[model samples]
Target: MIPRLKAWWRMFDTFTQRCLAVSVVLAIVASACLVQLVNVQLLDGRTTAEAATNSRTSKVTLSAKRGRILDTNGTVLAQSVERYNIIGVPDAATSFTPVTCGSKQAKSLGYCHAIDDKPVGATGAAAVARLLAPLLGMDAMELGAKLNGTNQYVVLKKEVTPQVKREIDKLNLGGIVYGELSSERVYAENTLIGALLGGVDDEGKGASGLESSLDDELAGTDGYTVYQRGNGGEVIPGTVTKTQEATDGKDVSLTIDADVDWYVKKVLSEGVSAQHAQWGVAVVQDVQTGEIIALEDSDSIQAGSDEAKLGSSRAVSQTFEPGSVGKIPALAAIMQSGVKITDQFTIPYEMEKDGQKFHDASSHGAEHWTLAGILQNSSNVGMITAAANVTNQQRYDMLCKFGIGQSTGLNLPGESNGVLTSPESWDTRSKETVLFGQGYTVNALQLTRAVSVIATGGINRQQSLIKSVSTSNGKQTSKLNTSATRVIDENTANEIKNAMESVADRWNKVINVSGYRIAMKTGTAEVAGDSGALTSIVADTVGFLPADNPRFVVTVVMKDPAGVHGGTTAGKVFAQIGEFLMQKYDVPNSAERTDAIPVEW
Candidate 1:
């Protein structure tokens, strides 16, 4: 009886061990299921939703219309034109079988035979290519190969006509697609202001000029659309889920006058060609506001010609020795420092200082001349002698105040600041040479504005090219006012103006207008070669019209002219431009005619 009872206990213990093992396996499997359920419900819920949406939804980018660039009088310089892009998606169509069972032979052959679908197959590609070849001026064989390729997307042409796009849409060809993009740039005046307006790149971004500088303001925001796509990545009908509208850019108005600009360009081109010079620049500015009325350069940048690429505007980019024009600013500085404006000097043919020689344009024995006489004669030696009264630091300060050694604030790309040596860097001869308009450089724009100080009553106004900005709602958003700074006393500026009147009188043989009293100064700068030897000359003339009551400041600069003096080459151009401005703007002649200032005091 005891042995039987022990066997029963052993059997019960073995059964309990087996039951515990099964329970442990079930617990492990239940724990894994709970962990996976938590991950799917909480950890990656958003990611899963996004994946599902991406599988069916497609995003399409929308292009915004670029702004128009206009002149001061609402003349459009650059604008956007409507255009389209021709596209082809080789795999946009699905596989299908074509059948023709209406014929008796097809009915007798038991049933309609399944033929290969011509819309998406090689046969379809060839047929479509042949149909579009004549309409699109494309090679049939090449287009057929493209249509038969494995590429999912391809652009066949850009800047396509709207009519052609409409014709293509009517075909209802499979795997063929086209869309419109309104980012193409069009020049309204065609190369008249190409350099200033700049050109657009292939991607419709501004490449240069004001277009590049104000790209942000000129380029509006682009929007996008989200829609459902079919299996072939084509937009499904009535499945547009979301869309955002595009905005157009603002309109930019420049300070230039189109009519005046055209006239100036004509005169400048003729002047450059007549002189057979390297280049030329002509600028006309309103001294009071510092608004550039008319500006032109020798390089005529054509609209669509890639061969004659527009070079930099030499008016503000190229720098050269200021020559006699430097004397105007020098004279202004000396007079502002209380030097006797009427002080007399004995100017000789040549004078030497620190082993360096300075001379007048012509050989004149020591002759008596006043400060005004020195400017009228453009005497280098006399200028150096007169400038000796002022310190080197004083001279440098005058140049700085006149806007030399810095940009003119024209807001154009690649503007150069004329070179003005620091006072500390001046040597024994540096001051003398610089005083006579040597050892320093200035571009045409800088030089013209510097001289405008005399015309603007001793105030320097910042030069500007932008006039205003307008929005699409036809509201004037902003109008810019050029900054003004007092550089010299009004009395001193008038005194220099009087002296410039005499300078213009001396060159009357070449630059005198019929009924206008013009105040002018001529500069003949010796152009030095790479080896520091004089090779050519730059002739320049800068001044204001109606000397008694100045209105417009006209400046003409010609490089490497056939003639040596500004009075002969640039002065004529200046006179011509002055006459045109007087007539174009209807500027009246001076109320009273004044006696000419003495050339030889």
Candidate 2:
């Protein structure tokens, strides 16, 4: 068998054996190629295709629209408007050519630059400058200089209106000119509530004021889109692979009334100027709801301006000794401790107690006066005498309950909590001074809320400026979860109201409002001046109108005024604002004070 096999192998010639060996090698190579082709085309096909598509695709950020800041009446205070930054490709502009007339694309172009029915003679950057100058309100020479740079991309103009951008697009300079979407924050009321509304940064984020505190609610979620782009850097049509819709921010509605705020500011500025005061602040709040209807400062700050970035609402930031106005809380504590409104005391111009001497604002002989008369005349000596009934701890507790040295719950930026030391920290003179509102300090809003307790039937409610927030779905009222606590009984509040009414009656000539009864108290404290000396005075008045049926509480504070007494300077300003409020709200005339409490024996 082996000999037969060897004989058969010799049957083929050398040339045929060599050709057959080459043919076998070629078949093995073909089989290897087929296996590789199957692996590449089937196993890794989807991944390879995706990688190729991703190379040409780009992701673009879609900015979410910022919400509007609205007043109580639905008036737009602050808003964001769509705008564009005109972009120029300087390198591309060098090859720009003017469009020809009678062309299909030219027919649709509303305004075209042409000479003798021919395209503009200028070419390159000059042509682009000439065509865009009129639309962009720029000088042709300057624009040409900017477009002649070697930079591939340059911002030609920033924050142009959408209408202007459309006109620029009509030029049909696709590669040379384009637009980048942007937004411009506009304040409709300008200086009205400017500092309170605050301003935003270059990235459109809130930088100060209520704008900063409520930034999260005002700045919605930003979306994005992934799409393929051509070599020219333009998005290819129908190539959007993925997109996420932007969620617009919710509109913030404030409890403030624009008209009331304007009037209060006008009155406050005039009063501050009249007295040659350093600065002034005023606040108006609803008695029942604790809504701040008006917050004003003497110096107006324009929103989005340099000044707005430097300061905020002084009504909540500036703190000073409340002076005699501070006496109300101490007196209330004394009254609640079984001291009758008609309780009699022999008051003098000055007196010594606990080794500390105290005096009234005026020098007078010893006279008999009741608790009501003591507050009406604002006698410091009489107050200290009455404060004897309540302990220092009781006095401090009342002041704390009145919101002294505590947060206003407004969440306003830069707000000061004011200074209120505990009874344990009080010295001999501090204890006596605390009785007449001299040792502790409070801001305008805090003082306003302190007085409002009487008007609210002895209940202390949390104050708020924000009314509600509106989204795409609908409007949702702001749930502040404000706490309300009973500071005194209704009877005690009425007694205090009657006493404050007597104080207003004594100042009838200074704070008179026709057909209206106002319960009021004035304050005067000596504070450190700019020179850091205790020479400056803070004169202020706080009260609620229609004293019998309280509605609104108004407070006015003047720093370093010519007239140091709160009753004369701040009192006059209060009258003007009170009169306007009556007419604005159409409030009913106050009933005659038939049950007036006797201020004297």
* Alpha carbon deviation, residue 99, candidate 2 (Å): 3.9
Model 2 CA deviation exceeding 4 Å by range: 1-56, 100-126, 139-153, 230-235, 480-482
lDDT of 2 by residue, 1-601 (tens): 9999779768889998788789999999999999988987999888888998886687867888899888889889889999998999898888776666767666786445564456777988998898889889999989999999678679899889999999888677776788878789999664787888888887889898878888999999889999987755688999998899888888999998999998998989899999999999999998989999999888778888767777787876889998999888888899988999888889999999888888999888887888989998899999888888688899999999888898988889879999999899999999888877788889989999999999998999899899999897886867443678899888888988999999999999999889999999998999998799998999999999999899999999999889889989999999999999999999999998998887877
**Number of residue pairs clashing in candidate 2, backbone atoms closer than 3 angstroms, sequence gap of 3 or more or interchain:** 0
lDDT of each: 0.77, 0.88
Candidate 1: what lDDT?
0.77
Task: Give the TM-score of each candidate.
Answer: 0.84, 0.87
Clashing pairs in 1: none
lDDT of 1 by residue, 1-601 (tens): 9999768657767779688778899999999998988897799888888787787786777888888888889988788888887777665422312224466754675434222322323345565565566658889788777777566567777887778878776554533555556546877553465565666677777666777777887888888899977763568899798899888788999888888888888887888889887888889898767888877777778543342224445565778887888898899877766776677888898988778887788987888888888888888888887877788888998988988887877667666786787889988887887776788888878888898999998988888778888889988865566678889989788878888988887788888888898888888888886577898788899999888888889989888888767888888889988999889878887755555445465
Please give the distance, in angstroms, between residue 204's alpha carbon in candidate 1 and its true position after superposition.
Answer: 1.2
